[model samples]
Target chain A: MFSRDRWQEIFQTIGKNKLRTFLSGFTVALGIFIFTVLYGMGNGLKNSFNEFFMGEATNTFSINPGRTSEPYKGFKKGRAIEFRNDDIDDIKKDFALYLDEITPVISFSATARYRGESNSYSINAIAPPYGDMQKTIIMKGRYVNAHDMAGFAKNIVIGRLVEVDLFGHSESAVGKYLDVGGVMYRVVGVFQDDDGDNEERMIYMPYTTRQMLDQGTDKINEIMLTYNTDIGYAGAMAFDLSLQKYLKAKHNIAPDDQNAIYLRNMADIVQRNMMFANILQLVVVFVGIGTLIAGVIGISNIMVFVVKERTKELGIRKALGATPASVIGLVLQESIFITTIAGYVGLVLGMGILSLMGDRFKEDYFISNPGVGLNIVIMATLILVFFGVLAGYVPARKAANVKPIVALRDE
Target chain B: MIVIKDLHKSYRMGTNSLHVLKGLNLSVEEGELVAIMGSSGSGKSTLLNILGMLDEADSGEYILDGVPIRNLNETKAAKYRNKFLGFIFQSFNLINYKTAIENVALPLYYQRVNRNERQEKAMKYLEKVGLKNWAHHLPSELSGGQKQRVAIARAMAAEPKVLLADELTGALDSKTSYEIMDLIQEINDEGKTILVVTHEPDIAQMCKRIIHLKDGVIVEDSFVEQVRASSYVQ
Candidate 1:
């Protein structure tokens, strides 16, 4: 609790020792500043990494065929491998209960013609389930359906950028006819993705229509599959091992041939990335707290000096009927005042730098909005109080313990 | 009113203990102006400190204004000190940073009086001490005599029953010293009991009663002819 007299006294004392007070306050401000900047950068790194997994299911994994790296039985190294359409049927018949959605992908770069406005885009032929599984947000119309695949209809879904390039950003191109390398298809949907230009410069069509155009019957590039619920780290690893064994057995490859087939599980990547982020956040907390502790120690040292220098004044106050509690209150209040003021300065400076950085900096892996959140502000406030109390307690006790008679006698 | 019986105090100088007060007894009626005089090491300072409640006696029975003064906690002791006593120190002891009125308002601030009332009472006391025009000036801006007057105003602002002046004029020249003694005399004439601790015979002669001490015991305690401090050249 502070009165006007107490506040005036604190300010007067601080003003009397300007350099000493500034240096002490600088420690706390610097600590909080470093904390805000470092923790914000850490969050930026985490979110940037998270951008890698965006617009796709975290529990999903993809299998890609690869050349053999080892020989087993009559099979030799360097032999190319490829997936077939029958593999999708076999996987579904066997693990239909465990799988949420499974689709084979076959994409190729093609030039699209919309009334003489041509743009080059990668055209991917996928099953209907792929749109929902990959989180493709259709801005207008609809994706390819089972009827489209079964009837071999000339229906297609164009990405937002492809629409802009071909349709001039005027309106939805749904129901419009577009020729893909002389093969005409009707645009049924327009989709956007978080991956920016890369996802935008693509097109989606039915797998059956792409297979018909491939000339290699039933050939597929990769199979993407996801579970109904999140499969954690251990589960993802176990699934990877089992799937690898099943593929090797079915394709007649060597059991120990490491490169026969490759698997990339989104769940495994998510788990590893999450663990890294958690460790980074924990390190920021420790470093921030460490910086604050150093600042608190500085405050404590300055307060001890203040107590020593004010011995005579304290004695005078005591002789005038100030209780020990009031003496302690005076010391503690001064420390708290200094620390809180310093901490606020740091907070404002730190956040100002972050906002400026956010405004000017371009997006990379960290994506958008690279700054501290509400939790960090709350945490910093709590630290201010803790440091204030900790830094002032010992010196205030010393002030309270002074004997008025002896102190007054001090020269 | 004050009473003390069998008060004893000592200081430890390394392994040996030096006894300062050995079974001292004293009594003073309300409104009396007394002077305590002693040579150095006579333990008069210690006795004055005991009387002011700034130090605890090793053994003593003391009473001031009908309340027993024995091992009171710091809080209660502070309350009693604020309610019953005022002090004017030789060095003035005015908080240097505060203005004259603010320095006078310090005790009332401790008493948790509201700001407006504290300032009003402080100004009243400052006017009583004849420093109303200098109320806003800092102690550093005032002369030695003016600073003592501010300290006197601060002491009396709480309206205590008794005033203790410990060498209140020691740091001032003779002219300023006589002026401060004259002010103290006027205050005592208003029926407030007062005690002055000093070594100067002239200062001691200004009081109605004088107590002499040597080697921790009172050698002489008697009434004396009171001299008017205002009659001295200032």
Candidate 2:
């Protein structure tokens, strides 16, 4: 019956103390805002990475050679061993059934020139199957073929940045002459990468040409491989270990050799970044929870004080046939009223800030667009109600305990 | 009807015990209009507190509407008080933020009274206290007399078995006090039990019975009341 009046009183009190209430709410809002932004960033980072790693040779492995270590059947202390082209053939032929595609690469940085424009660049000498091995999106032109690779043709492919620099934004850079290290090569293809800068400073040439060009280099710089199925993650991992062991034994190398060749799977980068994001999100939630707790406690303390002020009124109500439940309800309504209004204000402000931020900023490393979906809002709402009830507990009990006589006597 | 036996109450301020009531015994029957008079520290207010269940009797028994209250817990005590008690204080004790109708509607909040019904009843009671014209006026806007009238209407709203008033006219001018006294007496005549405490003999004399206490013990009980006729008796 009196619940209406209780709520009315709650709102009235809040309306009376607008500044204090807003401050408390602001703390809570800040907590939620931090958590929401962190989580959104985590998601945004995930989105960015997903965009970056658009499915190519996802679970793949490679093997590189190392230096001689211990006495591997009478090897010298500093004897360096390496894999020849034939050794690569041996591995590929032996693992042909399991192999998706393997492309050996050899390269070095040099200047790329078109007409009068010459820009410093890295030469990426890849096998004809390197396009499939690179597993990246092509923006223009066609990829080189096995025949072109076997014949060691001067055909070339470039990244969008390189294409822009070499051909001045011309889309049909294919078949055009691009001078790499003063040698003319025909542009065959172009690619678009998320980090255009990383790609623009590179030139792709036939692996055979690059290998022959480096007279001192008997082995390729790297090998990239892909698998057709993902169930082979474990198999792929084991194979990678075995391949490393094979290379070590045949090349007679030590495990700790600084110059030892090693594999770097892009999947590992993605996994590590994701883990970083998750940990970041956890930290954000802890901060948010801390803020919520502070706000809730403030609300509780203020509610207790409010109840104390209303002691005589409660007494009078009790004496006038108000049940303890009613008294409790009255105080509870006040607490919930304050919390609901305050929390809602906080939520709106938090979400509003996030929305505004989202509108203003593009996805970046530390921040993403602000978002408060149903889940976050609903959770905050529940927290507000719970905080309200907890805050109201003592006050409600005090009101219920008021002896009509003593309450009336209270000043 | 109400019965209190051997009611003892004390407040602990640090280690010192301030005895407010010591083995006080009192009784008020149905439809009785009574006043308990005492000076400061005479425990008149304490007696009122114990009677209203705003404080507990250290070791005592009290019965209201046939139910013994010594065994009641804090919450139960409040329920008992709410079920059968109504209180009016010298300060009027009206929630200052509430409009007259809302003030009158307060006690009913605990009663789980439906909203429409409670509003209707509050309006009805406000009219009875002659504050219907200012139903929306908050206590601050009302004169002391008007505030007390609103308080009186609030006390009457729950239809409690007993109305307890402490220094009901202490803050009011003579004319307003007399008017409030008349209203209270009229309410009592309507068959509601009331127990009022005051130091003013004139105020006590308004009741059908007066109990005077000094030092927490009743010194006198009387049936003789200073009779004052109201021009608008109804």
Candidate 3:
């Protein structure tokens, strides 16, 4: 039976200030819109790079000893650096923590033959841990074992295309012998590459055997090394200067060589991804929180104007048995009521806008189907209530403090 | 009942102070219909406001219901007014936004009366004042006399000990003025103390006693027989 005519009066006041309320809601909606979109896009970009790099050798560093801008060993600025097996041995000795397994890759095209099938394919002479350094995703069977390298085992793993072109299936290639340059080598393992294709062309042989049989003792094109530790940054930094200096001394080159073996730091990609993630989160927070702050300030400013306008009516109420606390309660309730309604309006619009974009936000790297989360909505609602309380505080206090006699006597 | 002793009120503009009431002393017992007759700026409205607790005297002893209230704060004063006082303004100061019944119920609403009960009480008072047909009509829709009638209903609904009417029918013509005076006299006869501010001796003649003021001081206080031209307002 209680008449909340006071609350109805407050509703009427807010209804009269339509544009002010609209602008406040718009600020909150815009904030939520930007936050959802940016987070989705940032995650999407991150996932794309992850997809491209996922199955590749994350632990191994390829040695490219060529192409220089500054002279090494007093050679011309643009010079190609070269290395042999002895240099690889010296590097392994210097940083034992850095070198897990050293695989010497020797590749060349050759005519391979079996009993009824004959095809031309590329051949690779590899050490025992060569498959791990190649970044090949092994789908079936084992890689070359230590015994295969020590006994000079006539075992080869062919590329995907070679298996298809010769036997038409990777499973059939295993346990069969294929003549590599007319030297019959049995298949030790059938493997698939990261791209979902069989890697059958690499006719792997022992490095010692490849040297003894093929007369390639002086030629090892690349030293493929995997770190014993997964702490990439420490391994990379520790190896950079020491490896360059060791190479300079071993090759009898200048100490500060502009052209040394090319080292790729995989940690750079990880660090960039991490930093971008933080930036994306910050951008979302700023845009979203900024909108909420603007809304609160707008409501607060308009409340000040409203209090000023209704001074006379409030004075009359004061003279009519209304307590200071009751006066404050009236204004505060009105403010909270107005902001809550407006915030809900904004929340609905913001969520709707984000959902409309969710279907189109497809990308490979990050979580693409982003929508306004309930936790964020709840947080926004709490903020609005706090905003209402804060915005109404000063005006309500002023109203409560009014002296009734002076208030009523006002013209 | 209202009583005042050595009451003083002044208005300051720049360095000059204009004394509105100077050393005034008077008393009105319950059931008394007292008309305060004074010209414009003779401080009749000022005295009325002070008695109603709507303004403070610079120096005075104002005792209403045997309690001193000269220095009471706004909250206490509002409480005092709500419990014991009602007012009828010359301009019929009913809130324009409120219906006649709502206007009548304003005091009860402040006192936390139940909604339906407050409406019922408000309508009863309005019917007594012959305004029940216009219960939902706003002040803007009513004639000047009808608005005053609504004001009277509001004043009576609260059942106050004293009704202070500041120029109660000042804006009405002669006939409406007498009708309002008759209502006030009827209320006084029923044991409510009524004090009216007026410039016309004709209005003053309707009351049991008259207090005449000039230059903010009481010039005379005596009972009047009747106005020679007296007739029913209808």
All DockQ scores: 0.59, 0.47, 0.33
Tell me the tens digit of each residue's lDDT in model 2 across A100-204: 777776768888878788888887777766666556567777776777777878888788888877677645687788888878888888876644577555678
Alpha carbon lDDT at A159, candidate 1: 92
Candidate 1 chain A least-lDDT 10 residues? A359-368
Q: Kindly report the docking quality category of candidate 2.
A: acceptable
Which candidate has the top score in DockQ?
A: 1
TM-score head-to-head 1 vs 2, winner: 1
A1-411 per-residue lDDT for model 3 (tens digits): 124777665565556556655654454444444444554444455444465556556666666676556655556776666767776777777777777777777666688877677877666777767777666645445677788777877777766666666777534777778887867888766676764443545556666667667764756767777776665677666775676677667765666665655665545555566576667766766766776676567666767766765566676566555667767777777666656665666566656665675636454334545555667776776686687577667887787677654555555
Error of 2 at A394 (Å): 3.4
If the candidates were sorted by their DockQ against the true structure, best first, what order would they fall in? Answer: 1, 2, 3
Per-candidate local distance difference test: 0.84, 0.72, 0.72
TM-score of 2: 0.79
The parts of candidate 3 lying over 4 Å away from their true place are A1-255, A269-297, A359-392, A399-411, B91-100, B133-150, B170-182, B199-205, B225-233
What candidate 1 gets wrong by more than 4 Å, as runs, is A2-27, A69-80, A115-120, A169-172, A213-216, A362-368
Candidate that scores best on lDDT: 1
- Judge candidate 3 at residue B42 and give its lDDT: 92
For residues B1-112, what per-residue lDDT tens digits would candidate 1 score against the true structure?
9999999999999999999998899999999999999999999989988888887899989999898899877777788888888989988988877789988998898887
